[model samples]
Target: MKLYPIESGNFKLDGGAMFGVVPKPLWQRTNPADANNMIDIAARCLLIEDGDRLILIDTGMGNKQSEKFFGYYYLWGDHSIDKSLAAHGFHRDDITDVFMTHLHFDHCGGSVQWNKNRTGYEPAFKNAHFWSNADHWKWATEPNRRERASFLKENILPMEESGQLKFTGLPENHILENSALGFDIFFADGHTDKQMIPMIHYKGKTICFMADLLPTVGHLPMPFVMGYDTRPLLTLDEKELFLNKAADQELFLFLEHDAHNEIITVKHTEKGVRLKDTFTTQEIFN
Candidate 1:
């Protein structure tokens, strides 16, 4: 199997919101904020080419949103799914499965796009089956007040409406082994209800897609949960358990939201699990 790190786009978000109650004095050291208190974030999606299937994990924030809507996030950079795919000599049509870690606009927004006529929305990848679990599908569709803003209908409903939406089986335990997408899925709930973190076995190593569960290296600390998380306490437990295991097993974490650090590994230190090292896709994959 071959893997590619797809650069969907880059944007800036309030560092305070990203690091939750963690004071700026601490998080700013790792994720330094700009003058406006905004920190750089990347919608780094992953593409896996295995045999007949080309599966894409997460399709960053698409370009369909209005300028006013996007202005809030401070979009930056020229990277787009099209350009990134072309870099790997592929296109949207080549994706057979679009497995989303969650339904947040920044995670799955690129799955749907405005149709040619501009009359309505359509599946962005005409040939791909959009993947989400039943629990998350309901959570996002019937979002609570706190998360309603992040789960936009324009970025979601079109996949189901187009008859291309598929659901992955929720595991009874935290880890679902041998999923339909050909990888183990680590189901996490602290960030959102039933957020699926893909544990991909590739190139003789396990690359865990660290979605919002661990947004950036700055979030490695136990209490450094995002304010957006509905259950911050639960996030602490999940992160502790996951990071401990990651350190013990020497797993490579494929960060989706870290603009600068692409892949990382953790080690057991006196202060608990901490960042051991970071690597670009070229260093790890090639």
Candidate 2:
């Protein structure tokens, strides 16, 4: 199996929102803020070429939103999914499965795009079976007031409407129980309801996709949780459990939202679970 890092693009978000209640002095040291106080974020996706299936985990924010809509996020970058795919001799059509960690716009917005006629939306990956669990599908479709803004209908409804959506049964624990997908899923609820974190076994190494549960190296601390999460207290407990296990097992963490650091590993320290080493995906995968 071969794994590729597909960088979609970068955008800016309020550092305060990203770091939650963590003080600016503390977070700014790692994720420095701009004059506007927004921190850089990447919509980095992962592509796995395993036999006949070319699985893509998370599609970054697409270019269908209006300028006014995008201005809020301050999107910036020259890289795109198409360019990144071409770098690896692949295209959207080559993807057989599009595994979404969650339905947030930054994570799954590129799953659909405007049709040629501009009359209706269509699945971006024409040949891919879009994956989302029943619980997350419902949570995103019928979003609560706090998360409603992040779950846009334009970015989501088209996948189900196109008849390409598939639902995976939630795992009883962190085990791959009858899951059609090749990877084991770690179901987390603190970030959002049933956000599936993929635990992929590749080349004698276990790589865990750190979605929103652990956005960046800055978020390694247990108290550093996102404010966007509905339940911050629950996030603390979940991070503690996941980080401890990651440190003990010596797993490589594939970060989805970290713009600068691509992959990282953690170690149990006197303070807590802290970052051990950083590497480009190629360093480990190659």
lDDT of 2 by residue, 169-199 (tens): 8776654543687888888899899998998
Worst 10-residue lDDT window for candidate 1 reads 277-286
Candidate 2 error regions (>4 Å): 174-178
Worst 10 residues of 2 by lDDT: 170-179
Alpha-carbon deviation at 101 in model 2, angstroms = 0.4
Rate residue 2 of model 2 by lDDT.
Answer: 93
How many clashes show up per model? 0, 0
**Candidate 1 — which pairs collide?**
none
Global lDDT scores for all candidate models: 0.95, 0.92
Tell me which residue pairs clash in candidate 2. none
The regions of model 1 sitting more than 4 angstroms off are none
